[model samples]
Target chain A: MVKDDMANLMKKIPIESVTLGIGDVARATGVAQSKLRYWESKGYIKNHAVTDKSNRKFTYKTVLQVQLIKSFLADGYTLTSAVARAQKRAIYLDALRSFFEDRFAQMDVADHTATIDLGPFDPTPSKHLMAKRTDQQWRFYLATPES
Target chain B: MVKDDMANLMKKIPIESVTLGIGDVARATGVAQSKLRYWESKGYIKNHAVTDKSNRKFTYKTVLQVQLIKSFLADGYTLTSAVARAQKRAIYLDALRSFFEDRFAQMDVADHTATIDLGPFDPTPSKHLMAKRTDQQWRFYLATPES
Candidate 1:
């Protein structure tokens, strides 16, 4: 039971400490290695150096940053604006992460329908905050265990 | 039915064009308007000018950006590094948004179990990718409509 709980918790939160080389990040994101270095030099992205200062290593987070900048650049934004826009989008992601970590208790599916159990309601702990979807429609309700 | 589809889609995607005044943003994010203006001047963030250049209105996206920067600053990151870190996080959010938009088919709950129906598998379109949770354990499987 303890192992299962740990696994469930680990699955919800991203591992931020995983580091990759600049080459690996460039390959994953499709951004050139030179461009990645330039962004780091410009203070738009960062690299984690282990022991040696010349060796560039980036966390999984930095790879995502590169992808975002590339996406904004593809959408015709200036480099400066792209970085700014990416920063803005990051905040929304933070909220989503928090929601998943805090409220996402469980998920179940039956007959093509999916139910996301958002744990218990704050005002009414006896009822769960359930988000249900059937076909393309989504509905939310507070319901007891029996219901 | 068409109106319902539109509403559903709109609910899934965030409205990016909603603009707020600097004061409103400051009040919402608890970051001073002066700091926001300074960040703008430094090209760390942006504002939309409706008719005049001096009248600054920011999109809902920018408001989120301010909050992210403030959070990172609280975490003891330098302003430049904080913005960079925020940009990295934004990429993860973009991927999450895409997943919710493209694959999230439905959700259902019964007997305290929640299921998330992730539409259909690309390799096997007839089977849906269902993620279910009962108690603290999560399980994933592919199932047909009848099953």
Candidate 2:
């Protein structure tokens, strides 16, 4: 089970399976259901396909995208431009996620200090990268597996 | 000068002074001049205030935002959603930049191997973080300043 959990953590989360209804998306994002529907119609957002046409479901990613779009709109971007900005942000979010998934190895806490193992450095099988956080400061270093 | 350069490296790059013309932004981002103007007029994007209204100028940040917006548009998001996405992505990019600025200490290369110093570990002034790269693999470890 632990191995299975580790394998699951290593892979990208299947976003398709975790879904929410339109109402939930609206509430979570503070976007009106009608506005979400309109954005979907215009291809500004997407929803999962369902057997019933009236039953609209969206992924958590869409929820985040909607929140971003709403924030951008509030920041004075026109609706059209806000959506564009949101889509572009998705790329960065994806990159951050990938970095976490690929590099994050293990974390240990002792005596209130936390050590984060960032996994192996590329091309060097003998060394691994790690960071220690103490009182809000992070220090990075390299260590062998035995250490 | 080396010290000055290191100080500058530790700080965030001042982006306000780096300005470009609308034409340059359009050329770089593949966005139309008229469209950019429209976005500016709608407050979708901001430009540096110029003395002459006819002479429009944008900052480098604006240039990146425009490029992101354009890319999102190509990805099928509505213009508004794309702009929103771009704004959200800016936050992530900022974080990445901050991480590099705060954590990256120095890099040394010799014998086809590169060592990246990530600065001192918190609370433990005696230890510092370092990563060695050889043949694409990275190994992280802790070392005292003498080492």
Candidate 3:
């Protein structure tokens, strides 16, 4: 029964179902092949099937990560900074999806469709506050709670 | 009293705080001056004082917006898309800041630091979802609620 349950869980999770080529990833993510290669060289991204320097295969998830990194770069972050943000975002997204999956699985058994309070999406204000506010803004808040 | 409050509110906000030249904006944001000029020309960003083609003054907010746009562009979005995202982010950030101010104002009167449930940090998943999921992922969720 445990074996069956494990198999079922594996099936539910998107566990390495499809593989994509570098070209496919570039096309899917709207990122140029040259940039993709550059990112790989810079260690910002990795190719799973690094059979050769010229030929490589990547998972769909890698494509997603590349897209995330690209979007960050587009927003004006340095390549290094973008990569860091992408990595952190990936972890956060994975946690959110896992939470959703676990909750959805339980909800299926009960057949209930009520709003689930996924408490405190992000607790840290600094993490979400992409822009660093000036000291004045902070002082204003501190000085005048009524304002 | 009302006029004084309005004046105080404007003063507290980062409205017309500091003006920066194109060079300063570029240096501060790590964006090219040429790109900043281009963005301004294209109406994506604004300069507070446009004296001539060569000389312009932008607010600190403009510098931040330019940085945001540049990051978006690096992420592989079209220039137009990046601009749109930057605009949306500006609006969202303002709303978030206002919410924080209101909450902080109330908390000051209460003298409490309890966990204020600012529910649904991300109401729109599409805006926040860095990677666009294929239909397969959605179908999986729909088909296998039990999983």
Candidate 4:
């Protein structure tokens, strides 16, 4: 009974839905595994967990974060901007979930506005905010109150 | 007498300012000859006339344009974004000159008003009009009216 209780508690621990190994991330991002390692060395990003007694494990969140970094670098952001402001720089995309969630909410508002008779001043922000990674590039809409 | 008149006209035809050359451009911009060549290859800029056939000469305008491209790329404008919609994109730093010029003109007006002690609402623009780049990524500024 005591052994079963311990196993049950371990199962209840929260786990991120998506897990990717370094090789998987390399394939998804079109970046070499060695380059990913280099980015990690540069403090751009890190894997989800380091339990890799043999190789590292990356989560989906980290994968997205790397994608962002790649786009920013290619766009010509210095490493500092590519890293985002120090406070906003999260190692995992999960850490960035709230921000992206807010972005999605903004997108919803834009989508809703698209169908409405919201007048000329009510512009759709979706077209404005572009997200990319070679160097940190973001074009986001600043929501203006309906005129 | 006709030949002498023609010679005088030729002499008066504006000595061409040495057509400024690649070596002069390298000296003026502190950009390596190779980097400038690479930038030209990358389509950031072009030189219209290359006289002195074997050595290759560039106009002073070409030199300035190269420096401008370097500044924009250094400041994080992606090559694609910078070149978007145009054969050659203008430098981002050029925007600074216009922004500041407007600010200075506004200060002159504000100064005159402060001396006369006019009410705040009397000499102000309604609903702030901002002239900005519609296509390029924007940086917002609170533009006051020029005095």
Compared with the true structure, what per-residue lDDT tens digits does model 3 show for residues A10-32? Answer: 23224233344565566556789
DockQ of 3: 0.02
What's the DockQ for every one of the candidates? 0.02, 0.05, 0.02, 0.01
lDDT of each: 0.59, 0.60, 0.45, 0.38
Rank by lDDT, descending? Answer: 2, 1, 3, 4
Comparison by lDDT, 1 against 3, better one: 1
The DockQ score of candidate 4 comes to: 0.01
Candidate 2 lDDT, A10-116, residue by residue in tens: 24223333455676566556689999999999989986755656466676567667877887898999999998876765543333344444455665544445565
Instruction: For candidate 1, write residues B2-119 as lDDT tens digits.
Output: 0112113324224343344576567557789899999988988776755665567664456556767787899999999989865544433333343466555555544445565666
Off by over 4 Å in 4: A1-17, A49-52, A85-147, B1-147
Task: Please state how well chain A of candidate 2 matches the true chain A, as a TM-score.
Answer: 0.76
Number of colliding residue pairs in each model: 10, 41, 17, 16
What's the TM for chain B in candidate 4? 0.40
Worst 10 residues of 1 chain A by lDDT: A1-10
Instruction: Report model 4's TM-score to 2 decimal places.
Output: 0.27
Candidate 2 Cα outliers beyond 4 Å, as residue runs = A1-147, B1-13, B50-54, B109-114, B122-125, B133-139
RMSD of each: 18.8, 19.2, 21.2, 25.3
* Candidate 1's DockQ: 0.02
**What does the lDDT read for residue A6 in candidate 3?**
19
Q: Alpha carbon lDDT of residue A131, candidate 3?
A: 14
Q: How accurate locally is residue B72 in candidate 3, as Cα lDDT from 0 to 100?
A: 77
